[model samples]
Target: MSYGKKEFRKRLLILTVLISLSFLVLLGRLWVLEIIQGEKYLFLARNNSIRLLPSRAPRGIIYDRKGEILARSRPSFSITIYPWNLSQEDLAETVKEISPIIGVKEERIYQTIEESQSPFNNIPLKEDVDLKTATKILERKLSLAGVDLQVQPRRYYPDEELLAPVLGYLGEIDKDQLQALRGRGYRLGDRVGRDGVERVYDEYLKGEDGGWQIRVNNRGQRVGTMGHKEPLPGNDLVLTIDRQLQQVAWDSLKGRPGAIVVLDPNNGEILSLVSAPAYDPNLFAGSLSQEKWLSLKGDPLHPLTNRAIQGEYPPGSAFKVITTIAALERGIASRDKSFFCSGTFPFKDRVFKCWKEEGCGTLNLKEAIIHSCNVYFYQLGLETGVDNIVDFSKEFGLGKASGIDLVEEKKGLLPHRRWRKESLSRKWFDGDTINLSIGQGYLLVTPLQMANLIGAIANGGRLYRPYLVKRIISPEGETIRETRPRLIKEVILKKKNLDLLRESLFGVVNEKGPSGRRTGTGWRAKIEGIEVAGKTGTAENPLGEDHAWFIGFAPYREPKIALAILVEHGGMGGKAAAPIAKRIFEAYFNSKVGEKKSRKVEE
Candidate 1:
């Protein structure tokens, strides 16, 4: 009887200990569920019942110096899908139902969903969808689980083709770009600047994005709005471009394949920048079609290229100004020194023929420039030597970028003896010097560089860095950033030399022949009231016809506008390029006159 009582008490003690331990285990699990792991589970539960949709902030508006709208954003609808909210079977069915309505293939929608970074994140299946299609998608929202009709801001370019190259275009962020920009809050399907001013100021132009959390039912339909955050619009950009002047420059091109750049000689502000054969930037506002993209990429004219900053061509006789400066500065030649051209210059084993086969008789520096005489420059090049010419050219910002605000500015080739030896493994010959003297045979320059070079001369040798943007304004109308005129360098040249060159250029447009008719090659560029000084060039091309060129500054006494014009395969500079310059000058002066009269009337 004593042993049985002892055994029963031991059993009761063991059972009591087991029950207490079970209570402790339950309490530990309750602490973990309500404390340590509670927030994570709560978030998961909320996420499953509620959808968080991101709202893209409207991009900054782009305006010209005159406050004319260039680019803005408009409300547009897009079809988006959340992969995590729906089961695999439901997601496939949703894509099938909406793909046909939105005119997108079901396979493409499935691929986009599969390639999305996270199931919780919304992937844009089709952007910039029309109202009719969006309405249809919403009407069947009950059946299409996890599919959302989202209103997004779409980029709009008002100036269209007139400012295509300058304004650039927007494109969706791809996988490669996402890796670099993900930390910056850039998500997949986000539109970013692809080129031009848009690209240069992307950070300032992109606004802060917001998000919305809304309650949803078990059927994947939004039931009630829970929370919302308004998006902040981006800052505004005011460019130095004048829309009127830009139009004039574009009109001057007239479907030609070339570029024209105009600058404010006083401040280095880009007044007009036009690259011909331009396309409408609005074509890229939405999802660009593969066929349209291929057409643009494959077009022979390459209308998309910003030729003003990228096209490198031989400056031809327009480069004679540099040669003349080098010759005079090096004391190899004087303004009064005369060269006799008997139609052709005889050198070792070959004869370099002048453009005028009949030969221009004895001519001095000033007269040679006015007549565009090749033989005169040929002799000057030979006397100046290649090294001296290269040195002088570098001082004028040649063989390097002009440091403009735009990207992809090509540093044109300025070949010297060392470069020839290193690049071609050949000895520099006297013939090479002669070719270099006339602005041919490996010497190349972009239209922007040539314009800046001429602008320096027009502004008394002060080279200013070319700029496009004038100021950036915030949404509160506060100036965030303003660009000031930046002086790049002052070209070292005697006042007398610059004056003499300036006078000779004036005669190039104003001088008349013995018959009282204009004889200068660039006489066609002469404005009636404005004293214009200019140079003309006919660049030789092995592939096709000669490229025509003209570089000039208007109102000779107080130069304001400086221009560089190029016409690819457009024949002589005087006949083709100079006329375009003349039209631009006329339009500019006439507009100034009109403005002055209007101001007087207001007074």
Candidate 2:
């Protein structure tokens, strides 16, 4: 407790050194935090209060050929929360108060905020909320901190289920999609195209998104806008589709489980495409319920399936056209050559019977096609062989993808000798050839393929790749891209043979037989003033009634519209499918005439 003067001086100096070292340590730590990690800490400090809020851009306007709008976007309201601005107590209170009004559980709201990777960014609590609910939240804004109402662009399909399979729909981005698209500015809770043209042209349809840097108070109430950017609208799509023709085709189906395709034969421009039992794309504009999703997946008819390109079926008597082509091209059968039929043909150990029990008696190549005689084709197919038939079918773009500008197109089954050995582990038999000749065996084709086949026949052996989109226009009304007729292949055949075949097809619709006792199979599709050529098919089905089909092109000399119509579980192609084709042709020609008259009046 007592010290001399020298001892006191020594203690004071030691105290001074210890104080200086403590200050030096403090200065070193401050230098590291401020100089070494200054930018990182500065960003963290700015993000704590100032946040970037994204503004959704409106999707492009989808238009028919005549400039009729099919799809557009409308303004909608959504509820969001800023978890970074709220304490634990404030967040709980906010969730509890708004949960009942928004029809969401408080636990879900809490879980959504807690699971977010970017708590600084606003998280949507409920999307596409009704105006009444939004109004209630606005009225209680002071009581609910960190809860805000914002406007978002929501997709709207004006025609509802009419063009769903073609236009597709939008959905929230999943984890996989976000990971794949993150580099392209996609983030959590972003919406993207799911299928159809929407998925195919997403880059052109999805415009640039805008955003704002806004300053918010502790309660998450926006106090000031630091910066803002306006969003750009997506480009417009001009499709080759004719809205009136589409309506007519849909009505002809009458909500059946089938498809109808109408296109320009010379150019492959699709005028109408209808797939029945379609779902509403509007249902997917907002959040879809799990129960409804499961119901759609479990439906027996599969409304989600695009029957035009995806459905594969036996082509029935329609295969006779291919058989006839093969026979003529290979010089196996002449135009006047005839075969006798007594209802059935016995080959090996089996008897293949004609559809008509009484039989077609005697018929030539043209008569056989017009009458759709099974026994006549059975004999012709045996003579022509399977290899020739397959080669001709491929030339006509059958048993392969039609190269259409659409998704999920199926290359139908084209059976040959090797296919049977590989798939069924059996030898190719005469019975198989007989069945294939009538389009009743392993040979499968889509309605789209049948339509394309008829188109090639009508266009004089030039196979054009079918296309739905004609042009893409910018938002300022400038044409950015236009699609022309793309010729896929041109079959090499004698002009006389093609002309004779065309004449025979013309008879199948207009010509009467044996003093009007029996008409050609496609006579029901006949138009009084227009020359139409078509074929009929009745595909066999073990589970139910046979599937009916008709393929036709009108104004036979200079054809305008080619069509393929199918009716699932509908008996007789002439009775069920031919009438529908007639109606479609009528509507199409009538519209053309109306356009001409309007142009004349304007002139």
Q: Give the candidate number with the greatest TM-score.
A: 2
Q: For candidate 1, what is the lDDT?
A: 0.89
* TM-score, one value per model: 0.91, 0.92
Q: List the residue pairs that clash in candidate 2.
A: none
Worst 10 residues of 2 by lDDT: 40-49
Error of 2 at 462 (Å): 0.6
Predicted model with the maximum lDDT: 1
User: Where is model 1 more than 4 Å wrong at Cα?
Assistant: 1-44, 174-183
Model 2 alpha-carbon drift over 4 Å, by segment: 1-44, 115-118, 514-518
Tens-digit per-residue lDDT, 1-603, candidate 1: 999999999999999999999999999999999899898668667787887888999999999998999999999998887766567788778877887898889888878777776656778888888889988988898898877899988899977899887889988887898899899878776889988988889889999988799887755778788899999999999999989988988888788899999999999999899998888888998878999999998999998898999999999999999998888888877779899998999999979878889999999999999998999988989988999999989998999998887777899899999899999999999999999898999999999999998898898988998999999999999999999999988888888888888988888889999999998899999988789999999999989999999999989989999999999999899999999999989988998899899999999
As a TM-score, model 2 comes out at 0.92
Give RMSD to native, each candidate: 5.4, 4.2
Question: lDDT tens digits, residues 146-205, model 2?
Answer: 777889889999888889878888888899989888898777877788977887787788
